[model samples]
Target chain A: MDGDHACCEGALAAGCRFVAGYPITPSTAVVERFARRIPRVGGVFIQMEDELASSIAIQGAVWAGKKAMTVTSGPGYSLMMEHIGLAVMTECPCVFVNVQRGGPSTGLPTLPGQADMMQARWGSHGDYEIIALCPDSPQECFDFMIDAFNLSEQYRVPVMFMMDECIGHMIEKVTIPEADKIDVTPRNYTKLPPDQYLPFKPAENMVPEMVKAGDGYRIHVTGLTHDYRGYPVMSADCQEELVHRLVNKINRNEEKIRHIIATDIEDADVVVIAYGITARVAVDAIALARKQGVKVGLLRLVVVWPFPEAVIRDLANKGKALVMAEMNYGQIYYEVERCAQGKVPVLLAGHGGGDVHKTEAIAEKIVEANKCLS
Target chain B: MSRTEIKIGGFGGQGVILTGFIIGKAASIFDMKNATMTQAFGPEARGSACSSQVIVSEDKIRYPYVKRPNVMVMMSQEAFNKFSPQIDPHGIMLIEEELVDPAGLPDTVTVYSIPATRIAEELGKKIVLNMVMTGFFTAVSRIISREAARKAVADSVPPGSENLNLNAFEKGYEWGLKQLEG
Candidate 1:
């Protein structure tokens, strides 16, 4: 299966009952699959007029008690920003897939890029946290999409399924497990009656229980600041409380949410930190460096946002230099550097867009970073 | 094998991508080697030439695109002219006899030609030319086993068309063997 097709299968397995999307290259396969299969699966796949409608339509489905998603590329992603912020503010549980292409605006329509990593984290207007996952192959694309949906359901926030064009279009063998073997997290539906329910009331986990609008509940959900009663509470105190709750829900549960694969790190003098397609490239580079007896490790960031700060800090504390490999002009480099906190020199094997970096270039960087062992 | 890169090229509607797919499937699924494929083409769907690259390796394939193809399969004159320049000097070349002309290729490059379209035409469907080419590729290069390619051909084609495609495969394979023997 190709990555996009695998993603569609993953969504189906994860119990996504509704999807609204505007098709764009590289990302179009997801919607195309959904449109074809949703009829048989007894779900709805809506082709909205444009990206803005596509973004908001899924939120409506989510509020109506449906697991939902919207897929897009660069320009579509940019248009969906306001809705992403709306999702964050209203605490909507949904998934968003960005099959990234080169772009500030409509850059490389059919090419690969990882420039949207930072944008996936901060494109929406606000001081809030989001969960973004990067999958390196078709198998990971299938597996990690389930995790994306499960995380979105568990925490009432939009999960970003960040894929690059290379992974989206690349074909590889993917083994999909039987449906019964898959574990999916169901939504946190409130058991309270209409009169007793407080829609915005936080549970012990800081995520409020959900109630469908037409379920005879007093639902007054709005984009503006609201209180536990789901009414407009226009004040600085309410603003502070709401923002803190939204951000801290993800920040406080970072340990539970962070999924990273750390390999060969015990005796390593340098590490390569990367995610998605770049991680595959790093694998070859690390192998090449190993041929010369350099013990380099890899920290594959499965979860790109709520950035894996503690792991990077520990590596820095142990005096291990880091190389951040990405297909962008230093977007994640500064983030890694911030986490390293000047403890060790951090290098970047960066490709601005269109194609992946050569393994030799990454291997050469690993050799140079290993010089800090002394 | 350490790594073997293959590029198959033709006009857009010639199942160019599908040809790359079967090879990858054969190597990775049946032969147990890892294979990765990526494609490129112009905007025109039929007349414009397109190409798909596949890398088969004992280890995982990192770079998805071909750097320089160790083997080239050309099914159209435009495809032959456009992509033959990047072939490894000693690479194996597979050509569709009627559609491509390989006059400028190096003498060191081992050439294998099969009338895949004519064979498919004889088999009553020109759409299976890619499958015929795939059979020729497997027979000539032996990079992927014949049994594996046969299994992949059965798995990749549409339902009810398996027999037609398998026949196409056999025709190309037989022709490839005779081309090598003669």
Candidate 2:
């Protein structure tokens, strides 16, 4: 199966019962599989008018007590930004899949790009955090998609499943474990009676329990800052309380949410930092560099958001140089450079999209970065 | 082989991508090797030139695309012209004899030509040309086992048309074997 089809299977396995999306290049296969499979699996797959409707409709389904998601690419991701902020402010638990392609606007519809890494973090306006996972292979697409849903339900944040065209379109063997073997996180519904129930009240984890639109619970879901009672609170104090908790819930639990795959980094002079398709391509480059006697290691970001700052900082403290390779002009490079904090030389091996980084080019960059150590 | 990169190229509606899929499926699922397949996207795939790149490896496949294909299967003149220059110096080139004119290829490159479309037509459906080509690829390249390729053909084709497709594959495989012996 391809990554897109594996993603659909993952969604089904994770109890995703509703999907609303507009067909777009590269990402269309995800919803296409969902549409065909959901009929027998007892779910709803709706092709909404555009990205905006698709983004918000999934939120409505989430409120109706269904695990839901929406899929899109670069342009459509741009369109869904406003609603992404809404999903954050209302604390809706849903997955947003961005099968990234080239573009500031309608760029390469059929090619791969990692330019949306920054957008996945800050595409939506305001001071809120969301979980994002980058899967490099078809197998991880299935495994991480389930994690994306579980993370969304765990923190009540809109989890972003960030995939590039290469991973989404590439076909590979994917082993799906038996349903009994797979662990699924059920939504945390409040047990309090209708009168006693407060939808926005936080548990010790700072993540509030959820309630659907019905069930006789009085709830007010709003984009504006709200109190524990779920009513709109206009003061800066309420904003401080609500927004601070929203950001803190993720920031405080960063260690639990971060997923990094490090290889041969203990005595390395140069480290290659990459996510999504770039990480897969960098594997070959790192091998080539190693043959030329450069101690280049790889730090593949499986969980790209929350930045994995501590790991990068730890590496910068010891490693001689870091190479950030991505399909864009350099989105995550700034983040890596920031975390390095002048401790080492940080370089960018950035492309303008359309295709993946050349293995030779990346190898050359690694060799150059290693020279700086000497 | 540690890594074998194969490119199946032709115009769209010719099952170019499906051919690559079956090959990858054979290697990964039946043969127990790792295979990754990616195709060229966009309008050119409608009826114009297009290609599917498949990498079969005993080890894990890291880089997905085929930079220099160890095997090139061209079903159209455009695909032949477009991709033949990038073939590995010691690679094997397979082509549809009736459709492509193998003019400028290097002498060192071993070229196997088959009238796959004609063979498929004799099998009662010209659309099965890709299957015939796939069978020929299995026999000549020897990368995927015959049993594995046959199982993949059956597993991939539409349910009702399995017999015809399998027949097409067998015909191509037999023809390829004859070519090798002679």
Candidate 3:
């Protein structure tokens, strides 16, 4: 299956029964695939008039006690940002596949871009944390969609699968497990009586049990700050507690949430950091540099958010220079440079996303970093 | 040795991207080699130029893209003009005679001209021309089992649309196998 469609199938296997999305280039195939296949599998798929409506509908489905998700590209993602922030405040569990394309505004309708990296982090208003996964290939797309859904339910926060057109359109062989082979994680519902339930109270694991509407639980949800009873409060204390729990659920689990694939970074003088499609290029550059007898390694970031600062800082403190490569013009390089903190020099290998970075271009940067050491 | 890179290009709807997918899938599934494929196409569905790149490597593929292609399958004149210059000297070129006007291509690369469209039409459907060329390429390269290519094509296509594709893939494979011996 192509990468975008693979996400749909992966979600289906993961037990996603509701999807609400607007049709947009590069991401339209995802919705179209779901529209055709989901109903046959007894899942609900809806095409909303706009992205805002799409996100709200998915949130509604989530509140109604279903594993739900939405798909969109750049412009659509922007429109849904306000609602994404709402999902954060409401503590809703859902998944979003932002198959990113070139954009500030409809920039490259059909092209690929990782330019939305920062947007995924801060596009939605307010101070809240989000779980975002960056997948490099179609197989990764399938695997990560499962991960995205799992994370959303586990943390009770809406998760983002920030993908690009390159991964979405590229077709490949993905192993679909037999019916009984799949493992699914369902949302935890309150077992307590409706009158006794505190909808916003954190469970032992910090993830709250979701009480959906019409369950006689009297669940009251809002974008405004709310208390454990799910009622809006005007006090600063309520705001602080609400924000604290919302951010801390995922933030406190950084050690568990930060996933990275590092290759040969041990005992190396230089390490290259990359994610998404650019990580693929960085791997080739590291190998080529190693062949020339340069001590080079790679840090491929699969989980973009939660930053993996500890791992990066450890590599930097180990006395290895870091080179950050990304399809955007220096979005992730800032984080690497901050972590390096003059412990090791950092280099930026950036692209504006119309084309994939050439391997030789990245290799040249690696060689230059090596020359500086001597 | 460097991994061999193949780029197949043609007007949209010629299954150029699917051709690349078969190459990548064959290498990974049948030969146990690492393979990666990427594709790009213009806005127009049929007349627009589309292409897919395949990289075959003996090692685990770290970088999943081809910087310079070693084999190029050009199914249209425009595709040839756009991509032929990047073909490495030791590479091979396969052109579809019905679609491409190969007037000035250099002889440094081993070039095979085939009437893939004519063959597909003779076999009863034009859409299977891509599968025929896929079989021909697989026959020459031995990248995957010809039987595997037939199954991959049949399995990939949606249900109820398999019989004609299966026949076309078989015809193309047999034709390609014959060329290798003759």
Candidate 4:
């Protein structure tokens, strides 16, 4: 299957019962498959008029006690940013699948890009946190789609399934295990009677148990800075408590949420940090660099947002030169540089992302970084 | 044992992407090897140029795109003209003789030509030309076994056209064997 189809199948496997989307390039296949397959899976597939309607429609489905998701590409993703902030404020447990294409606005609909890395982190106005997973292959698309939903439900946050067009359109074999082996986080419902349920009250992990609208819980969900009762409370105190819980929930649990696939980084002279399509190309470059006897390794990001600062800092502390390779020129390089903190040299091997980074170019960077050491 | 990169290019309606898909599926699913297929096409569905890159290897395929393509299959003159020059000198070329002329290509690259469209026409369907070429590719390249390619062909096409596609495949395979011998 293609990566988009694999993602759809993954959502189906994750018990996603509602999908609201507007058709967009690279990501159209995800919702198109959902429209075709959701009927058999006993779900609602809505085709909204635009990205705004589609983005909020999934939030409504989530409040109605359904595992919901929306899919879009670059332009559509830009349109949905406001709702992304809304999802964060409402503590909506939903998934946003962004099969990113080259874009400031509809730049390359059918091509690949990783330009939205920062936008996924801080696209919407205000300070908040999000969970974004980047899948490198069709198989990872399938595997990580389930993880995206599970993380969303566990954190009561809108999870971002960050995919590029290369991974979205690339075709490869994906093995889906049996139902029992797949782990799904069930909806955290308030077991307390509807009259006593405080909708915004945080549990031990700072994620409150949820209740459906028809289930008779008095829910006052809003985008405004609300208190634990889910009501609009305009005060510095209320804002501090609400914003801290929303941001701190993921930040405090970094070890649980941060997933980086690092191979041989601990004992390397130069480490290549990459994710999505760039990671695959960097792997090829790393192989060639290794053949030439360079002490090179790779740090492939499974989770891009809540960037893996500690892991990167540790690598930099070892005095290993780090080269960050992404499709977008310099979006992620600064992040790595900040983590490096002048401890070691940090370089960026990237472009604006119409096409993938060439293998030899990345290999050349690795060799040069290693050459500077010796 | 090492990686073999194959590039298939033609006009959009020629099943160029599906040709790469079947080859990748055969290698990865049926043959238990690792393969990845990435494709690109223009907005126009039929006339515009389209291409697919399939990488097959005994080990995992880390890089997705084709670098120095070990083999290239061109089903149109435009595809042949566009991609043939980029192929490595030691690579192999497969062309649809009815549509593409393999002139002005690198001298060292071994070139094979077949009238896959004419053969598919003889079998009463012009659409299965890719299947004939895929079969010929299976025979000539031996990247995946003929059985593996046959299974993939049976699995990929529409239900009613499986028999016809398989027949077209067999014709091409037989022709490929004859070419290898003659």
Candidate 5:
């Protein structure tokens, strides 16, 4: 399987009964595959008129108590941001697979890019938290889709599986473990009587138990500020509380989120930070650098959102020089600098979109950083 | 930590993608180091100018892509023309003799010409040329074990074609061992 197709397979394996998406380069095959496979598995697959409709339709499926997902690439991802914010505000548990392509507006429709790291983090309006996973391989694409769906359900938020064109079209052999061998997580549904249920009432953990529509509960969902009763409210306090609660559901649990994959930080002089398709390039560079007698390590951000600042800060305090490499100019690099707090020097290897970072270039940077340290 | 960057290029139906995965899996699963693989191309149903890469190292792999390949396998004339100029001076280049024109190769790099398609045809499996190239690569580079290559082949071949592929692979394995000895 390839990354995009694996995403569909993984979503299905994670109990996604509905998928709605537009046909876009690098991500169209996912929808095409789902069109054939979803109905075979007794699931619903819809080809929406555009990216916005596709996104909203998936959220609607989630609202009706079905696990749902949508897949798109660069241009489609741009069109879907408004509804992405809606999903965030409504606390809808859904999965989004954005198989990234080179872009600032179709820069390279068929090529890979990590340019959307910042977009995935802050494309939508308002100050809300999000969870996004970057998969570098087809198998990771398969496994992370399951994780993405699980995270979305557990936190009652949409999760983005941030893939790139490189991984999306790349094929590989993936072992689909026996269905009974894997552990699956589903959303926490409201158990209260229909009359007493408050859609916005959350537990101590800040995540509310979701109640689906048509379940005899008068569930009202919208992009506007809503009260606990799910009615639109214009009061400043109501707006503030609604946004804060929505953000806190993810923010408050930053320490508890198991989305980071950090390797060999202890006793290391340099920490190379990267994510998505570019992270794979960075990984190779670090290994090559170490061979040249530099004690370097890697900090791979599987979850690119919420930025994983705590880990970055800890590594900075440990005196590890950080190098930020991505297919974009400097999106995640800025976030790393903010988290580094001047504790360590931060370097960058930027490739706007046309070219990916070469391991040799990364290795050269590591050597330069090591020379400065020595 | 040792990092070696490899690029494998061929037509879409040549299993170029699987060979890349086998190399990466060898580095990650068998050798027990971090490995990252990336490929260029779409339209999975057909083979075009497909390319795949693998980065292998002792420590965790930081970056997954190769800027210029230290080793490259080109199974078609167009692929060879597209990638051969980028091979490092001391790098190794493997070409499919039936497709590549040796006259166009760089003087600094060592080129190994293999009759991969011919070998596969002789073994009654012409489509297994990619596997033959992969087996030859493992023998020459010793980057990954032949056993690992076999397992990768077994794991990746689609249903109902496994037996024929296994037979094809055994013939390729013997050819690879001979290349190493030579």
Candidate 6:
């Protein structure tokens, strides 16, 4: 299976019963599969008029008590930004899948890009946090999409599934386990009676339990600043309280949400930090660099957001030079540089989104990064 | 082979991508190897020259694209012109005799040509030409087992057309074997 199709299967396996999306290149296959597969499985797949409608419709379905998601590529993702902020503000636990293509504005719809790495975190205009997962292969695409929905349900935040076009279109063997073996996280529905339930009230984990509309619960879901009773409370204190919990729920649980795969970093002179398709390409470059006697290691970010700060910090403290390789011209590179805190040199082997980086280019960067050690 | 890179190219609607998929599936699913397939996308893929790259390996595939293909399959003259230069010098080349002219290819490459379209037409469906080429590829390259390729053809073709497709594959495979013997 290809990554896009695998993502759709993963969503269905994770109990995602509603998908509202407008078809876009690279990402279109995800919803196309959903549209074809949902009817037999007793689910809804709506092709909305536009991305904004698609983004919000999933939230509507979520409040109707269905596990929902929306899929899009770069241009559509840009149009869906306002609703992403709305999803964050309303604490809607729905997946937002961006099968990222090259872009600032409709750039290279058929090619891959990691430029949206920062956009997935800060595309919406506000101070908020999001959990984004980047899967490198069709197998990881299947595995991480399940985790995407589960994490969204667990954190009550819109989980961004960041997949580039390379991974989305690439075909590889994906072994799907039996349905009985897959673990799906159930929605955190409140057990309290309608009278006793405060819609915005937090539980032990700082994530508020959810209740569906028409369930005899008075739920006032809005994009505006709201209070514990789900009513608008337009004040600085209310803003502080609401925003703090929205950001902190993800920030405080950073360790629990972070997923990184590190290799041979203890004694390496250069460490290559990458995610998505770039990470797979970097594997070859690392081998090439190792042959040239540069002690190079790899730190692949499986979960890109809540950026694995401590891991990079530890490597920087160990005096390891860093190389960040990505399809875009340095989106995650700055994050790596910031985390390194000037403790060591950080280099970026970046490309401008039509094709992946050459192994020789990345290998050269690895050797160059190692040169910084001497 | 520890790793074998293959490239299949043709004009759009030639079932080029599906050819790559079947080979990858045969290797990864039936032969218990690792295979990754990536194809050309966008406007060019609709009706113009397009290609699909596949990597089959005993170990996990790291890089997805084919830098230089160990095996090249060209079903159109345009594809031959575009991709032949990138073939490994000492590799295998398969061509559709009715469509492609295998000129200027290195003598080191073992070139095999078949009238795959005419053979498929004899089998009553010209659309099964890619299957014939796939069978020839399996027989000539010996990268994937004959049983695996046959099973892959059966599994991949549309329902109720499996027998016709398998017959086309067998014809092509037999032709390839005769060429090798001569």
What DockQ does model 2 achieve? 0.95
Every model: Cα RMSD to truth: 1.7, 1.1, 2.4, 1.5, 4.2, 1.1
Q: lDDT score, residue A48, model 3?
A: 88
lDDT of 6 by residue, A122-214 (tens): 999989999999999999999999999999999999999999899999999999999999999999999999889998999999999999877
Shift in Å, residue B145, candidate 2: 0.6
**TM-score for every candidate vs. truth?**
0.96, 0.98, 0.93, 0.97, 0.82, 0.98
Off by over 4 Å in 2: none
Error of 5 at A5 (Å): 3.2
- Model 3 chain A lowest lDDT segment of ten: A170-179
lDDT over C-alpha atoms for residue A45 of model 6:
99
The residue ranges of model 6 lying beyond 4 angstroms of the native Cα positions read none
Of 3 and 4, which scores higher on TM-score?
Answer: 4
lDDT of 5 at A37: 96
lDDT of 3 by residue, A209-292 (tens): 887778798878889888888788999998898788878888889889888998888878888899888888788777788888
Evaluate all candidate structures by whole-model CA lDDT and list the values in order: 0.90, 0.93, 0.83, 0.91, 0.81, 0.93
Candidate that would win on DockQ: 2
Looking at candidate 5, what is the lDDT of residue B104?
62
lDDT (Cα) of model 3? 0.83
Q: What is the TM-score of chain A alone in each candidate?
A: 0.98, 0.98, 0.97, 0.98, 0.97, 0.99
Q: Could you tell me which residue pairs clash in candidate 4?
A: none
Question: What's the lDDT for residue B5 in model 6?
Answer: 98
- The deviation in Å at residue A70 for candidate 5 is 0.8
Cα error, residue B145 of model 5, in Å, equals: 7.3
lDDT of 6: 0.93
Chain B TM-score against the true chain B, candidate 3: 0.87
